[model samples]
Target: MRTLPIFIILLGIITINSCSKDPETDSDDQTKMFTDNDVLEEIRNNTLFFYQGDTATLSAAGNSPHGTFKLLFNQTALDALGADGKLAAGDTFPTGSLVVKDVIRNGNTSFYAAMWKQPSAENANEDWLWYEAFLDGSLLVSIDAKGNGCIGCHRANTNRDFVNSFDLH
Candidate 1:
């Protein structure tokens, strides 16, 4: 009986120590670290590269001679674009998220994306789009689910005066 209490205390200490390190269970969460380059790289590596055509495809070449990119549709993109009538699209149109700020929200993460060299048939400028989470200034994991909706929305902007063109240059 005398030694039982000490054993219990030791077990409790070990359990507490193990629990303290668990990221999922710990109350004090360590903020994820992400930089603009990290965000850009993740977007590039994870996002499904698409090309322009009457129908968007999985390949990186097609009507989109300059190449195309896709992003999710969420509040971030709407708010950013809504707030600013224009956003930079590298050197051309079709890709507005590069230097632009189009974003969408997916759970706790935010998605931001853009592309360059807008396909001529679609417009004079490239098309860029994104879905990002506006979670203050904290870092979060953003998955690039650049699905049909992305292409469909950009398709609507096929006209010369489509809202896709922010004239940010």
Candidate 2:
């Protein structure tokens, strides 16, 4: 009779323990840390230089893309670009470099696209992380170094160190 009570108590304790939340297993909450607002704050605080020269005009034929884009580079990235003022095919941006594109449509800032250099020997082939966020700085997309879409587009610009805006000096 005592054993029956003890077994039931043990089973109840096991159930309670199993139901408790473990931080390590709670990845859903962890992923929320990079939501739109968090990304916006990082961009506002970190980006240093804004490119004011000429804006890249996106074609209206394809997806009716209507935005005048401006480029912004963090200090580290600007320093990497240097005085000669062009990123060459062979030139590699240092790790921690960041470049951002701010898109304006109808005179209102629409969204931002950013690339961050986070190179490691293990992933040297594709070293940049890609991020996109709304004008309010809400994160729309974030792709790590191994991401496909950003790398695929950038691969075409391998001659310009995987950056399409080599002339944005």
TM-scores, all candidates, are 0.28, 0.61
lDDT tens digits, residue span 1-169, model 1: 8999999999999999998889887644432333334445534544332112122212223233212323232223333333233323332223222322234233222434333222221222223322333334332223233223345545544442233433211
lDDT of 2 by residue, 27-47 (tens): 554432223344356578884
Name the lDDT value of residue 76 in candidate 1. 34
**How does candidate 1 score on lDDT?**
0.36
- Per-candidate local distance difference test: 0.36, 0.63
Give the worst 10-residue stretch by lDDT in candidate 1. 49-58
Give the candidate number with the greatest TM-score.
2
Off by over 4 Å in 2: 1-39, 52-66, 120-125, 144-146, 167-169
Model 1 regions more than 4 Å off: 24-28, 35-37, 42-79, 83-169
